[model samples]
Target: MFVPFLIMLREGLEAALIVSLIASYLKRTQRGRWIGVMWIGVLLAAALCLGLGIFINETTGEFPQKEQELFEGIVAVIAVVILTWMVFLDAQSVAQRQSTTGAGSR
Candidate 1:
């Protein structure tokens, strides 16, 4: 229960950060008018994720114990993969930024 809540909270905040940054940048640059499509896409993604979660929960509950275990394992592996990728990408981005800034000061 807590795990799901925390995971969802973290993931939601991560996504929200990206959207907020884009929105803020747009406003700062006076291109805020184009934010409508970005907001719409974000809303659509949220809706799709919610719908998919509900469908997965309902469908998983309909399975037998063994099948449920298998499903849980698969979902866990997928989550691990996603988390790993996100962390790797974040580190790579940060490294690139540092390198670029270092080179620029030369």
Candidate 2:
């Protein structure tokens, strides 16, 4: 329960930060007039996400137990692959930066 609560809090903070950043950028660029448009876009995005989640949940509810397990396992594998890719990319970037700095110092 606490884990889920923390996850929700983190997601809410992320959305808030994104909106704040966008608003700041708009104000700095004198595009404040389009702030309403940005809000509309955000609302639409949120609605779409909610709709997708509902659709997936409802669709999966009809699946057999074995199929549901299989689906979940596939999703977990995909998530692991994506995470691994991200880690490798980050490590490569750090290695590149270190190599460049080392070369520059010599």
Candidate 3:
């Protein structure tokens, strides 16, 4: 559904931002040569994510109707927990950055 699509889009953007930040830091620190290694790591991570998604999809499709419903409910609860944790971490990061920039003093 559109909800899952939006969730995936947001997660993908978050991942892209994280990778860009790491690459920027490496470049700024004159570690440009390690960029290839970083790319390799990124590719491996993406592959692993894709593999996991496919595995889950296949496994869940084999479940009986009642079990499938239960599995989905569990997955939804876990997703909510993970999303809440991500929001908390983001807020903490923002707070830390603001404090370091003396924005909190104002």
Question: Which candidate leads in lDDT?
Answer: 3
Ranking by TM-score: 2, 3, 1
For every model shown, what is its TM-score relative to the native structure?
0.52, 0.57, 0.55
Off by over 4 Å in 2: 61-106
Give lDDT per model, in order: 0.73, 0.73, 0.75
Summing lDDT over every window of 10 consecutive residues in candidate 2, give the lowest-scoring window. 97-106
Q: Rank the candidates by lDDT, best first.
A: 3, 1, 2
What local lDDT score does residue 99 receive in model 3, on the 0 to 100 scale? 75
Query: What is the Cα-based lDDT of residue 24 in candidate 3?
Result: 63
Q: Write candidate 2's Cα lDDT for 1-106 as tens digits.
A: 9987986786677667667766765674468999999999999999999998899888865678899789778976775675566556555655675686674421
Q: Tens-digit lDDT track for model 3 on 2-105?
A: 99899789778767766776676567456899999999999999999899879988886577889978988897787667656766655665577677776753
Off by over 4 Å in 3: 61-106
